[model samples]
Target: MLLASYKAIRPGMQGIANRLIRWRLDGDYSHNEVVFEPGDGVDHLMPDGTCEPDASGALWCASSVAWERLPATSPRRPGHRGGVRFKRIKLDPAHWDLVKYRRDPLAAAQHFKRREGALYDWQLILGFVAWLFRHKASRDTCSEVCTEAGGQLEGHRVDPCTLHQIVAAEDRHFRSLLWLAAAGEEAAY
Candidate 1:
């Protein structure tokens, strides 16, 4: 299946609001994986599927599977407060496609740059192959990682310590940012 990105959000096919795109990726291929991102239509669903937000939001649309197949947690942990909906994630794509797509160095490099930088959590990047993008032992570890931006995701590697440093730096920066936001009486997402 070809996964395409949609500009607007919608209720997942299974009737749940896809608050985020959940991508479960393994090292070998991305087809079976999931990606999570901020979702729309969050206002339509309530803590218990009743009541409405001040206004309804957009919905998520992925070229992947049916929305109902996505995961969900009830009450999202009590307090009867706001409901936390979907997340958009990145997953591995098919391998032949990976190579074919990788041919475009400009695109591949851009994809790698996005992931290599601080935007991704250190554990997420260093352990990329272990989770959503784990490559089978038969496959080369480099295949699991890509040095290119369009996410060639093959025959590439990064030092684990470097990944940790990136994560730590990001954590500190985020914490400081949060503190500043709180001090100003506004929240940052």
Candidate 2:
């Protein structure tokens, strides 16, 4: 999933950081994640300890995030608020542009599941914004997690928006799930 921050201070936006990220990276999206479980045929356990019925559906995604509200299921870093987190999110077009990748799902799932508690790479993010320091990322960012899971070796240098382009260019490797028409215009089909 790729998250767009095309508008500044839009509703549901976390803060100005997203806009800054877009500006610095020159990309429409500021965040990305891997949805290992598409929530089509299996029930999901919610953060509040309730079983979410599979009939409704939810995308089970994982990434390193710095959002205001971290999902309850996310593992916490010792002194920080953000890190690698798993979330159950609806595949809403308003927020996310979904992409389907042709990859080994089990391997990707296993790779990210082991990184559940990894720290968010603020240094790398900061490098993009400040254009200064380039630290060895002992931590991971959202795009890094997604790309690495997708078997991209150059994940470290890619951002959310760039990943979209990369996937788009590789037709056999990825496919977009988003429809081009507006929501109400789907009936025209």
Candidate 3:
């Protein structure tokens, strides 16, 4: 229902919605959850579970965080509707990165184009970090992964390098995911 509602409100923001769902969790490595205000959303589907009108929501799901947290249902807060609310959400880790993958297609297709700088950059980084678990080698093998799309691996605050977490690891991991999409265009043949 969240995805459907998201698609309805702003078809383009579906990617954002996907990440928002992933953000409902909290744990060690990363706390990626969205605490919703009562009636704000996410509870419309499970009106029975939540008596709070503006409940703060959180999404504590992922590979690394799985270490400490349990499924959202078992250990969820008292006000929460438990996993029954998200029972249908696809918990597969592969899909976990789908939000990251759709960034470019949605952008290149020109679906969502607004805002700039850190917020924009973090959108990409969050998605990339969602699935980016590798050595800091995105720079050497990939050019688009650099900050500003194409330039020397100079001093930049964010980029694939940052999210990839290396000396050159800028906070622009989000762009790196978009770069991945741009590069994929070549392989379409």
Candidate that scores best on TM-score: 2
The lDDT, on a scale of 0 to 1, for candidate 1 is 0.28
Q: Which scores greater on TM-score, model 1 or model 2?
A: 2
Model 1, span 1-189: residue lDDT tens:
112222223444422222222222212222111111133222232223322222333222111122123224322222222212222333222212211121333343233223221111223333553555542322222122332222323323532223223334555677788888797885433
Candidate 3 stretches greater than 4 Å from native = 1-30, 44-48, 51-64, 71-189
Question: What stretches of model 1 exceed 4 Å from their correct place?
Answer: 1-157, 186-189
Better of 1 and 2 by lDDT: 2
Q: Write one digit per residue (lDDT tens) for candidate 2, span 43-109.
A: 2222333324245576566677864345555555534567777666565677666655556665566
Ranking of predictions according to TM-score: 2, 1, 3
**Ranking 1 against 3 by lDDT, winner:** 1
Per-residue lDDT of model 3, residues 1-189, tens digit only: 011111112145544544453353221112121122233333422324441433333331111111122233332332332111122233234332212221122221111011111111233334445655332321111111222222233322332212223322232575687799989997896
Model 1 poorest ten-residue lDDT run: 28-37
TM-score of each: 0.22, 0.71, 0.20
User: Which residue pairs in candidate 2 have backbone atoms (N, alpha carbon, C) closer than 3 angstroms, thus clashing?
Assistant: none
Model 1 quality (TM-score): 0.22
Q: CA lDDT of 126 in candidate 3?
A: 42
